[model samples]
Target: MDAAIEQPTVARLITAENREVPVSATLRYRAHDPLAVFVDFPAEAALDGEAVTWTFARSLLDQGLRAPAGHGDVRIWPYGGTRTVLEFHSPHGLALLQFQAAALRRFLQHSYQTVPAGQEDVGAVVERGLSALFDEV
Candidate 1:
């Protein structure tokens, strides 16, 4: 199996003025981090002109595709019939992004192909995490 799956996509950033700006992003999932999904934004998308990555639960993305999900830093919900909205909050500020539902679904499907849902090797993930932590200590 592939170590990771990455899908490049274009997302619309909803500005405070209620305008949409196109942004480049990548959705990533790795077998090694079975429970997590990552969204990567390039430097041009950030105010500081530095790349940023946001990590959230894979299950959250799946649930959000169908309905509203998440209550903390990240929130996701379906918008209309064809779009999905993802909101991320940070100390710096908040970012609202819109993506095509079909695109997100496709990415999820590809990730499942690599590491099927409910079959994540959580034990192996834990072992690796602990090993890394102890090595740093």
Candidate 2:
């Protein structure tokens, strides 16, 4: 049988206006290391080349959020699901997306504790992933 880590999955990045961005995303969970995702975009008008990649780790997301308490115009949880939802506001519009993270959770659980393993532990996984691009969301 093929190794699970060698496999990849798809996820949808949605917007408030119903616009969306489909991403080829993956996760890697290394022992004594942090949790992170590798996102690849297939050439789109809003984004750059087909090789446009946006990668970030779980620690990065955990440290950046102050939600339910964040005094701002938005909130998000990027690493909070097998099928995760990322919702945040942007200068152009409200950007939101739903993604598959089951493989991600398996990878991280191999040696790290990246995503919360509960139906209600979602915090700010999505906002952190999108914050690098979107402004003030």
Candidate 3:
């Protein structure tokens, strides 16, 4: 399996005033962090003019596709027949973004191909974390 996978897609930022702004986003999955997925946004999409990345459980994304999921930081739910809504909360504020359901589904499917569900190597993940932590000391 590849070390990482990245799927670039466009998302519509749902403004407070009920407007949609197109934004570029990427869905990323890493073999080292098999249980998690990441969403990367460009600096322009952030208020601070810095690139931002959000990490959340892969299971949360899978569940969110079918129904509402998450209680903190990240929340996702199906918006309608063809769109999905992702809500991200931070100390600064929150963002509401809508993405094509098909795009998300495709990305998730590709990620599963890289590291299938229920087949994540937990022992390797822990060992790598421990090694990195100790190396920093």
Return the top candidate by TM-score. Answer: 1
Q: After superposition, how far is residue 64 of candidate 2 from its true place, in Å?
A: 11
- Cα misplacement distance, residue 55 of candidate 3 (Å): 0.7
As for candidate 1, its clashing pairs are none
TM-score, structure 3 vs. true = 0.93
The best-first sequence of candidates by lDDT reads: 1, 3, 2
Candidate 1 C-alpha error for residue 35, in Å: 1.0
> lDDT tens digits, residues 1-137, model 2?
21223235566777446776676654443222224444444466244344444445544433333222222433435444345454445464644556554554454454233324342223444554467568755
Model 3, C-alpha of 71: deviation from truth (Å): 0.9
TM-score of each: 0.95, 0.43, 0.93
**Where in model 2 is the C-alpha error above 4 Å?**
1-7, 19-22, 28-37, 44-46, 60-82, 87-95, 111-137
**Runs with alpha carbons beyond 4 Å of true place in candidate 3:** 134-137
lDDT (tens digit, per residue) of candidate 3 on 48-132: 9999999999999999999999999999999989999999999999999999999999989988898889999999989988999
- Model 1 misplaced stretches (Cα beyond 4 Å): none
Task: Name the candidate that leads on lDDT.
Answer: 1
Q: What is each predicted model's overall lDDT from 0 to 1? A: 0.95, 0.44, 0.94
Which residue window of length 10 is worst by lDDT in model 2? 62-71
Q: Whole-model lDDT, candidate 2?
A: 0.44
